[model samples]
Target: MPRRRQAVTIRHVAADAGVSLQTVSRVINKEPNVRPEMMERVQASIAKLGYVPSIAAQRMAGSRSYLIVALNDRERTIAGWRNREGTDWVDQMLLGGMLTCAEHGYRLLVELVDTHNDHIARELLGAIAAIRPDGVILTPPHSDNPHITQLLEAQGISFARIGSVKPGAGFAVAMDDAGAARLATDHLIALGHRRIGFIAGPNEYELSGRRVDGWRAAMAAADLPTDHLLEQGDFGLASGRAATLALLDGPVSPTAIIASSDQMALATLELARERGLEVPADLSIVSFDDTPIVRFVHPSLTAVVQPIADVTAHAISLVIAEQAGQSPSTAPVIVPATMAVRASTGAPGAARPGGGEAQGYAGPPAGAGIVTEVSSDH
Candidate 1:
């Protein structure tokens, strides 16, 4: 019979590195002041042995679980996956969050919970009891949920809120959603589109309102009438289609339309085709999130590319930092979002200046992205 390899643990790493068990723990927890050469040697030994530290052992070795919990909207996320619509928000989040957590010797865990669950406290408590995460991150609808924030507050857990600007308990790590929306709207306005239409996300999300506000503000600034040009969507394909239909069938036909989500934007594109209108020629379209699929469409979408990975990484850092008693109480993060000019948008009568296909914008140089870190009493 083949021999079974024993599971590798921190002790094996310590023994192989010829260091004290505590030294290995320090390296695992990313504690400061460890000698550089010792850290290297310990890490080298761990790699050689393929030592995967046990999370339970980690919990026992310290007051932390070394786990960062991220809460996402349960219903919407599931629907997106089940329908195979394939939103890349979670993927981008993992790319940024997992990498950041690994650097800090932590793990990123995602939990799906109903945003409006009446037993929200119980759901949160159960998850909290099971994982005992070092910190929590609230995304989208949950970010604006006061109940979750209140419970996390009562339980003394460090959390970070993404896509929220409300003054609350958890650290607020947010994107410039409004600024990004304004950027998109302004781009369309500059392209000689007079009557631009705007489709907004659901009211449950705070960022949705912020985006709508930006679009409205930009239109008002351009001295253009926004009457009959705004429609509401739930960030879903069906809702987007309904909203797009209303905008197209309204009193005045808009030359350009901006949908607040990739799904919604795709719906707009679909609706336009149904109406026999050419993208960016007969109609110009812009959308948000800059999802991966948008680039492959017949008329690639012009999108507001929020720095998803960088923003997520920054949020993870803030959560871990706050848990470690570091500062950054209530400063606004300024992660800049860029407009990816594509074939979908144009000068009302003409296609966008370049070839319709375009690459998503890579974010700014490292260390320049601003992230809001809200500190807690904990």
Candidate 2:
């Protein structure tokens, strides 16, 4: 049997550097007021001896656990979002949080709690006690839940909210969802779409209302009536498909439709094909989120590109800063969104007297333009 190498310890480094163990510990922890020459000697000895600091020991020396917990709601079912892999937004947020945590020498713990459950506070409180996280991050519907925030506050825990526009208390990071939705609507309007339809997400999310308000604003500005142009969806493909069918079968059909999410937008595309409508020729479409699915689909969708990953990273950074005894920023952090126009949108077809499009009326291609930053106040 071959002999196994022994693990290196701080004692080895301390002896090698001809310094006391306490001096080596102070140097390793980067404590203030250490002599520059002594610090250099300790570091060189540690490197030469291949000595690695144990996380357990580091925690014992500090008041922080250097761990953050990100809580997401499992009860909110976004249609066609989850698969064997995972949902796009959740995966993106995890990546952002994990990457940021690694950079700060911290660990990220992701938990899915059912916010809809009556006993959710009790369940979450138990988890908090077990994990004893240094901070927490709340995502979507969970971010808006007052009970969760109240419990965290009662426990004297630090936390940050992601994707929340009006995070009543505590730190928050979000993009201008209303402005993003308005940008999508304006894209269709610029392409000569007068009767534009909107498919909104579920009412459970505050963002859904913000998006609807944006659509209404755009329609009102263009002097267009929005009486029968809006349909409700649950942010799922099935709801989107059903809403599209309802909108198309109605007396007043829209030439262009903006679905609140990429999944719903794809559903709209599928339904349009079944109805024998040629994309951008007979109808135009725009979706939000600009997820990876939009790029790979045939007749790639025009979408509002919200910076989900960046917003999540910012939230995690805020939590870390707060845990490190830094004061939170007085103003909320707002990220901006852009528009990615592709083959899915163009000028509306000329309408006949009976609401049918005239043949050989292929619309011009959509122009590439940037979505300006609209004010976040809306």
Candidate 3:
């Protein structure tokens, strides 16, 4: 008869390794406090017996596993984004949440709703209820949605927004879009480019409107009339190219164009080349959200630097603070932007005679646009 196979148990491993059951547990669970040599022995015994740890048994032991959930809406576009494997806005939010959860000894779970889903807000709320996480994080424009906001409130769940909501809304860590755009526009004006053109990002994007507002405000302050010189983009390089093409082909071509994002700005350069226009010589340009790639472009981009790290950190802090029973400020914390001027701008030049020639350009380039830098305010 074959020798009887020995049963594998935590006690057997501990005894074989000349240690206590708790020591075996410490080694098995990969927890702290086990002596190195003893841990090795326990592992050797377990290997000798071919022992396997039961996940169900571990869960049944009343061990706590903390988790947090994040909800995002990608229906609108985010500026300064180059779609690689994992650098998008949604990924940033998830990583930020993970960092926050790690600080508090918790896990982060992310759920992405379908862009075409109509009842997304409702479905998201249901997921939250089922998961029952310690807390949740919301990213714009979802954070700005009133219906979703009301639903979260009704459920009595705690959450924080990664971007700004309305003035009276609570718990937001966001960049000041209008302020930053103002700075970008101002940089161009100071550089002497009076025939400035504005390229708007996605219409549905909240920041797009804010940036345009800043552009308009700056122009208005400078006593400049903005009419028919603005074109919209879908926050893609292709959109930027098309918008710029349209602007250049029109009768009154602007000497400088301010793209809402860097990808769009780069696209503007490509279009300018195709149209036989030289950057900073014939047509200066500026873009927003200074991504790393901007510096590597043929003409290093003149941009509005957005602090991604700060925004992420602030959002994490807000969510954790909300979970700790400390309420975040009702006012959104606005991060400042900076003017990273490079080779894309210069002084204004003579506009094509009779500004009416540029009838369809949407807005005029007359005033200073707001530019902001990163900040750490609650």
Candidate 4:
């Protein structure tokens, strides 16, 4: 039988680095005021010795699980929105969390919870008992759920929140969703779009309301009326398409439309094609979620680039830090969002006799002259 190799220990690392085991322990725990040269020597010895610290041993030595649980709402259906592979927002969040956890020698576990369910607290408690995660990361809907936060607090579990409109207690990370929406709406307004349409996400999610508020704020600032231009959607492609079709068939149609999600924006593009409207000429479009799909689509969508992955990663980091005995910040960590102007938006056109463009305004230089194979079916 072959002999198994003995695992490297802190004593070995100390001997190799010419330091005490206590020094090795302090360096591994990332304590402050360690001599720089000694710290570097210890780190180099650890690398050269290929010593993989046992998370369990570390936990036993101090107090930690080195595990994180991310709770997301499973009731929110994506439907046709995620038909195109790799565009799912959940996938993005998971990827970000996993990567960040791996870097910190921590494991990430994802759990789906139906916050709307009557026994959600019980179910969450059961899951927590089974996993016993060091910390938890709450996604939208769950992020704002007071019950979940209270449960965590009562159980003595640390948690971080992502995408909460009113983040309360513990570590939280979120982007300025309403500000991003306002930026998108203002872009259309700047391009001479007065009668602009908005397709909003479902009201159950707090972010949906924040986005609506942003759109309303921008229109009000521009002295534009929004009563007739706003439409509600379920954050799905079908709802976006239906809402957009109804908006087009309404008594007064908008020259430019902004949908809450990239999938919704794609629906707007499809509907415009069905109605024989040329993108950026007959009708301009803007949307949120700068996912990878938006970049490859015909007339690449102009979108509010919400830092979904970044926020998730930051949320994981915050929980990890909190679990490591760091005090949680009272204020949420706010990530900034930016606009990615693509081919889909342009200056609005003057009215034609039958909703045709009297004058076609060219879009930005980057979007100019980019052609696609979509047919005009009107």
TM-scores, each model vs. reference: 0.86, 0.82, 0.69, 0.86
Candidate with the greatest lDDT versus the true structure: 1
User: Regarding lDDT, does 3 or 4 come out ahead?
Assistant: 4
Candidate 3 per-residue C-alpha lDDT over 136-240 given as tens digits, one digit per residue, 9 for 90 to 100: 666665666666667777766666666655653446767778887787776666666566788998755678888899899888877665675699997678899
Minimal lDDT window, size 10, model 3:
355-364
**RMSD (CA, Å), each prediction:** 6.5, 5.2, 9.8, 5.6
lDDT of 1 by residue, 168-209 (tens): 787777778878878887877877889999999989999888
lDDT accuracy of residue 263 in candidate 4: 73
The candidate, 2 or 3, that scores higher on lDDT is 2
Tens digit per residue, CA lDDT, model 2, 85-147:
237787788788999988776789888898788999889999998888889999888888999
User: lDDT scores for all predictions?
Assistant: 0.83, 0.80, 0.67, 0.80
Task: Candidate 1: list runs displaced more than 4 Å.
Answer: 1-19, 35-52, 351-378
Give the local distance difference test score of model 2: 0.80
Among residues 3 or more apart in sequence or in different chains, the pairs in candidate 4 whose N, CA or C atoms overlap within 3 Å are none
User: How big is the positional error of residue 236 in model 4, measured in Å on the Cα after superposition?
Assistant: 0.6
Q: Model 4 over residues 1-378: C-alpha lDDT tens digits?
A: 989998999889999999998788777766556899999999999999998878788777776767899987775634333454454677789789999998877888888898889998899999988877899999888888899999998998888878884746667688887788788887788778888899999886788998889899999999999867889898778899998988888877988998998778889999999889988777888888777888888777877877788899999887877765676575877777878777777776544436432343333444355432211111
Better of 2 and 3 by TM-score: 2
Ranking by TM-score: 4, 1, 2, 3
